[model samples]
Target: MSSSRIGLRFFQNSRAAFRNATGPFRRPGAQGFRFQSSDAASAEQQSTFQRLWNSPIGVKTVHFWAPVMKWALVIAGISDLGRPAEKLSLTQNGALTATGIIWTRWCMIITPKNYLLAAVNFFLGCVGVVQVTRIFNYRRSLKDSPVETVKELETEVVDQAKAVASEAEAAVKKSN
Candidate 1:
């Protein structure tokens, strides 16, 4: 599994997943190339890039996830301590941090001249991102036990030692 990092491709995939609500569709481009069916085809263009995906599908996704994310942010921020996993506490914090930055940026742009506060919030975003990144260091609970693993290693070592001893004894008898 990956130790998560944000990427443009991830956002693109997320947006596409929301738009299609199935998955990203690969299509043959007219110019003899591969492309995403959503963007490559002009006829099905739900909304332009400038609109920030306000189309029906996108709106539905946002509406569904917005409140959920808000509640999750509260819970994860309050209790989870950014627990890291494929789709657990780490994902929650990651989403929260990303949304915090987006909301802060939106506030900075929409509000009347709050550059100082925006700058502070930008720094807060940096802090949230750094904290969220800590999730990668977290270990899952339901994994193999270290003690059992060590015991298995010990058995293998003992068996190898016995094999080596038997080989040495055979060598000694042959020399005699």
Candidate 2:
């Protein structure tokens, strides 16, 4: 009848639709029950499964390996740094000179490599933590949202359609 009533009815229908859409998650044997269609229902199920699999823990575990590998490489590089420079050449002066040259070259190379590894590890670890937080937040939001039953959604939709039809009829009579 009134605009407010119409708006309220629309919201009620929408809420009902939302509930029907999410109802399967609440109980067993609720599959195939949908306000939309079977295709939409299946899509929802697939997306939910995807979200679960891509959860914070999963993302963190995947991202963790990068830093671990980086650190291992760094440690190996450090062990190489400790080896005798004399092994590079034969005579003492020659060995000293060769070792100096080798050590200097290695030091130069390792400086940048170590920095790069540190930077990569820091970046990846930060990305992993952020992804973990995002997944957790998404899951929390989904859990907090209310789910509706199909029966309630059907009833609400029927009520809304009737209300809209009645409003149209009343408007026609008023115009007449």
Best candidate, TM-score: 1
The runs of at least 3 residues in candidate 2 whose Cα sits more than 4 Å from the true structure, single-residue gaps closed, are 1-60, 86-176
How many residue-pair clashes does candidate 2 contain?
Answer: 1
TM-score of each: 0.27, 0.20
lDDT of 2 by residue, 86-151 (tens): 232112222223333344344346522433334544443443343334433443454544243334
Stretches of candidate 1 above 4 Å error? 1-88, 115-120, 139-176
- The numbered model that scores best in lDDT is 1
> How accurate locally, in lDDT, is each candidate?
0.51, 0.46
Q: How would you encode candidate 1's per-residue C-alpha lDDT over 41-158 as one tens digit per residue? A: 5645546652435333233344334444455445445454444334444444555577668766775565244444445445545556766555333331333575664455457557
Clashes of each: 0, 1
